[model samples]
Target: MAIQIGFETLVEDLPGPRWQALFARLWPGYRAWFLRSGAVARPSYLESRRALRQHMPELVPTWQRLVELAGGGDVEARFLSLWCPPPYIVGCSQAVWIDPAGKEEPALLRNYDFAPALLEGSWLATRWQGQRVAAMGDCIWGALDGQNEAGVAASLSFGGSTVSGTGFGIPLVLRYVLEIAQSTAEAVALLQRVPVSMPYSITVLDRRADWATVFVGPDRPAEVTRRKAVTNFQHRIEWPEHARATHAAERLERLQKQVDGPGTLEDAIGALLQPPLYQSAYLRGYGTLYGVAYRPASGRMELLWPGVRWPQTLATFAEGRRDIVYTPGAEAPPDPDDAALAQLLTESRS
Candidate 1:
């Protein structure tokens, strides 16, 4: 199938008209996803709001504004809180690469692998929390990955597992990081405070070549490491089946090599644009929709594909759209060891 996705660049400094329009267009789908197991499956509105305030107190004002713009309904408020939301899985590969320039700038290179249909595809330049942020938006106000004016950039990959617990989703946590963190160490410290719903490996890079990959999950404390590259799994391969299905080990090895090399930023991106780093098994729930690079020293970012590069900086962000078609292969055949796969599936995600 040839999947067509329309990506938009909305340059807004606050929660206002443009944001409301986005919420109106995306709310219905988000509502359905939020209530997949029924409204009671999620926490109460008050509980959600309390969690937001307790963990991300700095974002309380912005969260309130977004809730108001989203129509101020109970479900809308809870959904925007991103507290204990539905379990979602995305396979991706990311790395921390330093430029070989005279000053050695740092770049966060990432490939967001997931279904094109499920991608919100919003590129936003905003100062919603008094700091300029250029980010790929998700959950209406959250970020898939983003950079702050202070030169801290971060990206995420789902840590391989079926385990989940009571906490906020990783997207909101990422949003909080860009809103307040000024460096990689600061970002890592902030990440440790927020409890996450799912396992995720967040790679953070700052302008001074300071970077670390922080591994976080609902059931465990966040772990900050000097590792330069991360794929879906973290620490060790927790989900062997998923690790195999997504070629997680292979992809991680490739990214680790790239991050460890003395390659330029362009060289890192070039490696990401090719296989087995570039994924296409959309039917199996992981396809490389777009590759992105964040240059903290230069205060710029760019998106990449096979033949396209969309570059922008906070000062020169343009409001526009890119409609790209993705042609991905079908799902791989099921494993012969159905009984083992079935047992893995029985693990509770709640």
Candidate 2:
């Protein structure tokens, strides 16, 4: 049996209603769970939205709807993941399977079981929000990575050394970056200013194409600048002895070598989706759960996942596998019912 993968592409203009509808169908249990958890506090959601509006006023209404869903706790965890876009470009792997065989009609539809509820609960507890910002870990239904409208992306790996005293977990920060930033530089600026207390690596890719990896641990903050790509582990020039011995860094280095020459978006995706460099327990431990590719030029994005176990590389599904083909200038409507997000304000007050 192999892991299952799902894909979705949301245009800037698609009516919010459409997304709400799709969300209802895909993750029916989200709303009930959200209400039961009490994770949707009024002030938190309001603050998150206010912060977000400061950067993109157009998102005000959407943030409100998110708030409403939060109050009833009816907002399902999976729906939370699907609702917002990642703050920056991100990609990662996981160790679970929906279906070992690829014969299912929808491919990865059954794979949702791999991520259980404990992960979902942890994600909600770690969620972050301010007047104009909001984000959560284990978003998209407990997937190990995600971001917010702020332009930040958080991908995770089970590396060595586990330190505690959580400031703001990496996924929540990723969500915050996306909610507040209009570009990559702004995201980096936010990281530098904030005080974090976890040991994790976050790769932020801004809309302007500037990329940076911030390594947060119990000691100091180390950062690496990137242009073409970023992977797990340390990649910054500022860090000397910080690099770990995990396969994550080695795979990223190997891919960097292969792309020494000019490459297309497809080439980059290929390199990212390929297997890890040195085969070991880490390879299977941190297998890719999914891959997120962002094209700032067109405001377009793609989420790729390994369709089968072996031989076939991951497939890109931004708008249907064969729909956009990762080209430039691809356009879609921003979801409108998302406007109902404003309604969340009223619901939260109640």
Q: Write the per-residue lDDT of candidate 1 for residues 154-194, one digit (tens) a residue.
A: 99989998789988888889999999999998999998988
User: Considering summed lDDT, which 10 consecutive residues are worst modelled in model 2?
Assistant: 104-113
The positional error of residue 27 in candidate 2, measured at the CA in angstroms, is 10
lDDT of 2 by residue, 32-138 (tens): 43343355421243443443455335444544564344433433322342323211112232211111233211111000111211122211212223322221224
Best of the candidates, TM-score: 1
- Backbone clashes in model 1, listed as residue pairs: none
Off by over 4 Å in 1: 100-104, 336-350
Badly placed stretches (over 4 Å) of model 2 are 5-68, 71-137, 140-160, 222-230, 235-246, 277-285, 306-350
Q: Candidate 2 local accuracy as lDDT?
A: 0.36
